[model samples]
Target: MSTEAVAVSAVSDAQQHTPSAPAQEKTVEKVNLLGMSRPQMEKFFEDMGEKKFRAGQVMKWIHQYFVTDFSEMTNISGKLREKLEKICKIKAPEVVHKNFSKDGTRKWVFRVGDGEGSLVETVLIPAEDKTGSRKTLCISSQVGCALDCSFCSTGKQGFQRDLTQAEIIGQLWMANYSYMEDVPIADRERSVTNVVMMGMGEPLLNYDAVLNSMRIMLDDFAYGMSKRRVTLSTSGVVPKIDQLAEDIDVALAISLHATNNELRNELVPINKKYPLEQLIAACQRYIKKDGNESARKHVTIEYVMLDGVNDKPEHAQEMIKLLKDLPSKINLIPFNPFPHAPYGRSSRNRIISFQKTLSDAGFVCTIRQTRGDDIDAACGQLVGQVADRTRRAEQWKKKIAQSNEIMRSQG
Candidate 1:
């Protein structure tokens, strides 16, 4: 059997044998085929005593045609379709709430699990470039994040479980399906041109699901998106970065919020475990391939500009020295604030000055425009209702409350 087949079968067998809860909690769950890649699906069919080609037909139905019902697949025989309907499903997450920004950014709050608190947000951001207009869907990997990056609101919510493969790819499926409501599949143009795994959680933490989902995104039977157009952002997970280089090839972005070791350690706690030196070394290795488009592919250094935090001229100088060897383009993101957030957005002048330093220093740096802030769908602002498993949310709330009390008392 192929590697994908073995892995897929192992996952299927493991889930099948898992213990069920009591009658009150127990519910019939069908295999959701939404997340499976082509090779995995081929293996699934081979295991079921069906032709492997059935996998491609089913993939086109689910991803390309956006047909959720097995009955709608006219090409498959009635008997096989009936069997698939009985044992499997093509379900995506339920979208509970949706918001459209005046700037054409769309946000959806999806219920990924059974409870009310299982919500995760996905955003579609439209941009115009030299080529043409493009829409990028930001995908969430986990329900909530464990990495407590000081400025991000999602981190304030604390850790929750990693999202399954279905939940991960469902974001793209739903985003694209939204446009096909009125138009027929043949007439439908791709609504989302690119995808960025930069939403609610640290992506590298949820490795397997994320990798398979991304492979689906790149697969011709599915999204057929270019590997470069699909970017996966991580908060400096070093080992995964190396492992990722081996498993698949896609654009990688580092959440390098701060430049130096001390500031980065304070801002992104993951920095303490995987320091700037280690992360930089890994990045250098990641972009080392030759004689391909990936050879010219530079790692994106995502820096969120916080007022008096990491937006200083000295910080820009630090970034220059740090990224001197690595081929990277710096993206300066203006901080987006949320309730009781510790940091403020860097002033326009300060951000401009910082960008100028890098631009002049020969680093291709661009400031990220703050978008969908009205709907709280902007970067670092996605805070879906998380049933925080860590109790870190409670601690964070208490800390914020105390800070407010101290200020009020001083007044």
Candidate 2:
């Protein structure tokens, strides 16, 4: 049997034996205004017996003006403000912990709610180009990932519930407000120039919330980011790829870590459902220029390099052949190590050689620089505290303990 088949069998066995956690019951009343799109917000106001324009006014106050407190909305009448305060809430995730890396990378661990509250992580990567410093916020769409890729730390934490639209967009709002805390109010244009949905979970799995949040990000009253500036990274959810092309026009990044199905199936289990050929076909459809010729966008192919696993020269040659026809750029990421991580980062020399192979093949290949690793904020290193619904967290803990015991015995 193939490595992927063995892994899949193991996962199936685990699932068959492991017991699931009991579901909780809770009641929520107030409307969280953070994630609703323009139409939804307008409908909300209309349903509340207020003028439809109140939605736009409130959206501007909450998003553009950075005013969360209803009392701070100065232009609104006192009676309206009181009514809004009683019925609505500008809900945002609470920042339970914040860490700043030496390279100015910032990571925030946000608390989602009460009673074994789920935690999600967001990362701000600072980059300096010829123009100026650009900050990109990597936001999470779910509390934890369900797709358990062997190499990802977040997947090790086990499956958790999808985040609400508020939780998704609130990440951007909180990051922007935190960045502009010291700047003058009049000069505060958002510090986050780009946003990427590549943090904790499979974004496509949480489609509606992610799409709604992206719309809010592109809304003029909110972040006002260009479609090119926002990216949605997926682990090859084939159907969602086609859905996204119809729903939004943001840039797409595929988390394609391996060259073939034999490897990819083990690295990304979703490949088992939607294989490489199907995924590539979906990408072709996604980038098809239906009517607009000038708006053609290239998909970003993200390949994480793991030492002695998928970083060989042969792998690079295979990648060149795989991506030959697609309008794409390859982003080679060096593996970021986490506690009990099964793989090691590819050597710098190996990474350089891999980039050269793709560059020689007439592809635009760039090696991603490692940032925020010290604070566990780099790629593939986000592991938030999740009350695992699948009991996979306990299994991971036991595996790590066994590994440590074996090492101690050898010593």
Candidate 3:
């Protein structure tokens, strides 16, 4: 599903920037501080007639120390803490269902947007890199998706709403907190070192919130994550790609599942609007870096291998041709099937052959190991409960039913 949805009504967008009221006020309005970046938080404190330095202190408490309660911030004076307790709140989405895979992958199903069954998921995967053990958190920017990329289970579930900045970054906050909650602040180290925005929704669609969340992630007082450690994956949102290059410096990944326009249009319907040529041009622009070849970065091309589709030698050769001039790394993901999914994973030999072709051509190619499939936490398996506004979920259900009936008749 697409990322153009907000779970709120007509006037909800304006509510994010409004100031909170103290407990003495009739409404006792509270502003959620979980989503605010350092600048926003500094403005918040300034507006509250407090010192701007309080922003860094509070941010360190909330992000580094994982302190949600204002009263628990001992270094801050009791009066200011009391005032903050009355008018401000550091809150994250509630974890509804938490599951762990045997392979050290963890998933959390979060309840968001008034809790009307609009669920989103987050995943934390532990792995080993050249440095040492690293945990990468897969964060979702939207509840469900609007871009119905035919192979994705979230698209079958349909789009519901764009997650608030708090909800978007809360997945990372919650995941990091899960590990450090029992440890002392001085001795605690970050559990999650990397983040990938490749889960659930198209992140660029929820532009502002996603951007602000990444800002907070890169802030030193907050998560202190490097721009290199955070990657934003999209289904070729062309204009946003350009805007992202201007706005932030995070690594970019394209969800490119096909080599040609005709097949891509069928697989990723958004390709109809932003075709392959335009998409590749945008990626090139994103990594251009003022044409300095020495400091140029590479974009990541994510291609999911299907049994008889997009996995043949011809397709690999076409991919090599498509990416010959661009600086990129190719990740070949095995198709993870969900209920009624129309595709199947390519065989190991076929995937190997495809990887060999690209690798032999002097491009970096790696196969993504299937992980957390049993718990439905693999790459394409996250299907959080979505209140489908597009009615795409109902249509998919009908389509599945028709396919099942055809199979039964043939039997």
- Per-candidate TM equals 0.91, 0.88, 0.91
Q: Give the residue spans of candidate 3 off by over 4 A.
A: 1-25, 291-296, 379-391, 401-411
Q: lDDT of each model, Cα atoms only?
A: 0.83, 0.81, 0.83
lDDT of 3 by residue, 1-411 (tens): 111111111113323533333436535345778888888777667666678999999999999888898988999999989877866678899888888999988998888866354778898888888979989999998877889998888887677778888898889999988887788877666689999999889999999989999999999999998888989999999999999888888888999999999999999999999999999999999888563332238989999999998999999999999999899999999998776677899999999999999999999999987778767886435443423455676788788799989999999
Clashing pairs in 1: none
lDDT of 2 by residue, 111-196 (tens): 88666578889999999977698899999988778898888888977766888788898899998888777766556667898999
| Residue-by-residue lDDT tens digits, candidate 1, 41-86 | 8877888778999999998888888889999889999998987776
Counting clashing residue pairs in each candidate, in order, gives 0, 0, 6
Model 1's lDDT to the true fold? 0.83
lDDT of 2 at 76: 89
Q: Report the candidate with higher TM-score, 2 versus 3.
A: 3
Which residue window of length 10 is worst by lDDT in model 3?
2-11
lDDT of candidate 3 at residue 245, scale 0 to 100: 83
